[model samples]
Target: MTEPARDTIHCARFLPHPPAAVWRALTDPELHARWWAAGDVKPLVGHRFTLDMGSFGSQPCEVTAVEDERLLAYRFAERTLDTTLTWRLEPEGTGTRLFLTHSGFDLDSPMGRQAYEGMGRGWPHVLERLDAALGEAA
Candidate 1:
């Protein structure tokens, strides 16, 4: 018998900011901390980063991939379930199309279900915060 596979969650946004701008928000610790619940990040690939939002348990994560002005991916560990986050940017008419996929979550398991639901509820607000930050920076 094969092991059951984990369900994945995908969230996407079309931002009114350039891909470079979105890329900065995704990669820079200060820029990310302004929106996402992130802590000190080394700002370099293969480096460790931590995220603590005062409520969610502090997560020890790592930057796994980076492509200038296009993509950023990370592995977030130290949680009830381990996962990988991928951010992709495509240049659109005026700004960029930002896509996020948080894969490796088991929607069937209690913890995974909670994580999936909570992130689905909370990330939109976080994305809004990112928009405001981008506007301010513009």
Candidate 2:
């Protein structure tokens, strides 16, 4: 018997900002566009939106869970990628410890494998951009 694929990307970053600032960057469409894709993201569950992923085109997403400045989760890329992206925030000293989980990649398929590999390499840079964006605003 073969073991199930453990295909998930986990990233954590310590932002020198409060949880509220990090939360805003994750949910506010304008702020989000600066660090990542432009989307009508909100901290309310069931909100549906699309992120303009440049060459990757527009990717649909639906908010699945939220907890103020604590946590946010959404279905990402819908039919194509079919993954969930989750963010969690924790207060650490005078900063916020942010965690990200990108899950549900069907590694057996070519598209899934490619996305898994590509995104795995890409998320760190994205987080760095997030940090820089926050820094600029401060």
Top candidate (TM-score): 2
lDDT (Cα, tens digit) per residue for candidate 1, span 1-138 = 964345666767889988888888877778878887767664468888888857667888888887788877888764667888888899998899888888888777898889878887877777789888898878
Each prediction's TM-score versus the true structure: 0.86, 0.96
- Per-candidate Cα lDDT values, in order, are 0.79, 0.95
The alpha-carbon lDDT assigned to residue 113 of candidate 2 equals: 97
Query: On a 0 to 1 TM-score scale, where does candidate 1 land against the true structure?
Result: 0.86
Model 2 lDDT tens row, 66-99: 9999999999999999999999999999999999
Candidate 2 residue pairs in clash (backbone atoms < 3 Å): none
